[model samples]
Structure formats: C-alpha cells, structure tokens
Target: MRDNYREELDDIRGCLVDMANSVGSQLSKATTALLDADVTLADLVIAADDQLDATRESIEQRCFTLLARQAPVATELRTVITAMRIASDFERMGDLAEHVAKVARMRFPDSAVPQEVRPVFLEAGHVAESLVTKAGTVIAKQDVEAALELEEDDDAMDRLHRQLFREVLSEDWPHGVETAIDITLLGRYYERFADHAVSVARRVVYLVTGEHRINAAG
Candidate 1:
C-alpha cells in the first residue's frame, strides 16, 4: 500500500509536467496565429482551451482525493497542495493563450500587430514560450536553481511588454486608437502568461526548499 501511494504521488507530478507542456504548445500556436493572422489556427487554439480546462479539473480532483485519503503530511502534503496550485496556474496560462487567439480571430485576415511593433510581439512570444518550457523542466525535476532562472526569463517578457507600450504611446505613433487597444491587450496577455509561468516555478521552489517568495502583484 505504501508503494502504491508513492506511485500515485509520482503520477500526479508527471501529470503536472504534461499539463505544462500542453500550455506551452497552446501559447506557441496562439503566437503564430496572431503574427500570421491565421483564423483557422486561432479557432483551433480557442477550441482546445476546453481540453486544458478538463485537464486542470482532473489534476485538482486527484490532488483532493490524495489529501482526503492519504492525509499526507509535511513534504507530501506540500507536494499535493502545490500540485493543485500549479494546475490552477496552468489553467490561467492556457486561458491567456486563448485570449491571444481570440484577438487574432477578431482581426482576421489582418495581423493584430502592426508593422512597427510586430517584432515586440514576436519576441514576447519567444520569451513566453521559453518561460513555460523552463517551468515544465522545473516541475519535472523540482530543480530549485532552474526555477530561479525562470524569474530572470520572465524579466525578458516584461521588457518586451514595456517596449510595446512605448511603441503605442509614442507621440508620432501612426496606429489608430483601435489598433493601440489591440496592442495593449496583446502585450498584457503575454505579460500575464509569463507571470503564471513564473508562479508555477516559484511553487516548485517552495516545494523543494520550503522557501516562499512572495510576489507583490500576486
């Protein structure tokens, strides 16, 4: 029975890694859809959000069951609880990706990102993708050092987001208010996506080291 219980815990951890990977894939597709104005790809990303929701539910249920049945304590208890929180973060990340896709769909046949700031969105996409990928690695290995690196990776996303605002707010900006709104929204989506990824990593850091780093915005 002890061995079985341990296996169950390991399974839950594995599921977290899988969910992280799924979120990364969704963000990547949404970025492509946004940059290329591919409505078909955007629609696919929006539709696939349901599956991410289902995955989150399954992960939470398993965590709850373990808590109720095993009454895990100390590290084991932390593991179960952290899994639930990380799953929630993944769900939010997935939703942010969906939002990006929706914007692409709304401006179908024309890229939501204008030529002046297309590069900013593109770099933000790359940063977002890298953060999530490292997040998956952190979950899979519980490497506190790698988890720390995600914070640095998120800084890149923040920089890109700020750059985007500069482009929209420039005195000589050529885009209309509508396009500026789209750019603002898209930048926020990427920034928040990176935040969730960092949140997941911080959870892992706490799980491994028992050290909690508080985020002011969180």
Candidate 2:
C-alpha cells in the first residue's frame, strides 16, 4: 500500500512536468502566431488552452486524492502541496499564452507589434519559452542547481520588459494609442509568463529544501 502511495506521488510529479511542457509549447506557438499575424494559428493556440486547463484540474484532483488516502507527511506532504501550487502556476502560464494569442487574434491580418518594437516582443517570447522549458526540466529532475538558475534566467525577460516600457513611454513613440496599449499588455503577458515559470522552479526548490517560499527576485 505504501508502495502504491509513493507511485501516486511520482505520478503527480510527472503530471506537473508534462503540464510544463504543454505550457511551453503554448507560449512558443503563441509567439509564432503573434509574429506571423496568422489568426488561424492563433485560433489553434487559443483552442488548445482547454487541454492545459484540463490537465491542471486532473493534477489538482490527484493531489486531493493523495492527501485523503495517503496522508503524506513532511517531505511527502510538501510534495503534494507543491504539486498543487506548481499546477496552478502552469495553468496561469497557459492563460498568459492564451492572452498573447488573443492579442494576436485581435489584430489579425496585420501584426499587433509595430515594426520598431517587433524585436522586443520576439526576444520576450524567446526568453519566456526558455524559462518555462527550464522550469519543466527542473521539475522532472528536481535539480536544485538548475532550479536556482531559473531566477537568473528570468533576468533576461525582466530586461526585455523594461525595454518595452521605455519604448511605450518614449517621446518619439509613433505607434498611436491602440498599438501602445497592445504593447503594454503584451509586455505584461510575457513578464507574467516568465514569473509563472520561476514560480514552478521555486516550488521545486522548496520540495527539495523544504523552504516553502516564493523567490525574492520575483
């Protein structure tokens, strides 16, 4: 019976890793849809978010089931709790990607990003993708070193986010109110996406260390 309980805990960890991979894909595909101005692809990305939501719900339910039946203690309890938290982060990450795709769909047929600032969003997308991918690996391996490295990796996304604000607030800005608003929201979406990835990494760190704290950098 204890062996079975341990197996369930391992499966929950696996589910978190799988959810992270799906979220990473959503971020990448949303970025492509945004850059390409392809509403069709954007629509596909939007539709696929349902799967992310469903997967997270399943993970959360498993957490509850483990708590009720297995009564995990100490590190094992931390494992279940952190799995729920990480699942929430993954769900939020998916929502952020959907928001980006919705932005792309909103400005369909023409790029939502202005030419001058396109590179910023592109780089932001890449950084988000990189961070979440790293977060997934950290969860799967529970590597404290790589988990800690997520904080440093998030710096790239933060820099790009600041650059975006500078562009939006510049005296020479010429994209008009609509584009500026879109840029502002996109900047936020990407920033939050990176934060969610960092959150998952931090949880993994806690699972390993029993620290149970959010990262300071975030």
Model 2: CA > 4 A from native = 212-214
TM-score of every prediction relative to native:
0.97, 0.96
Worst 10 residues of 2 by lDDT: 209-218
* Candidate 2: count of backbone clashes, pairs at least 3 residues apart or interchain: 0
Note the Cα lDDT for every prediction shown. Answer: 0.90, 0.88
Residue pairs of candidate 1 with colliding backbone atoms: none
Worst 10 residues of 1 by lDDT: 209-218
Candidate 2, residues 100-171, lDDT tens digits: the string is 999999998899998888899888888888898889899889888888777877888899989998988999
- For candidate 1, the lDDT comes to 0.90
- Residue 49 of model 2 has an lDDT of 94
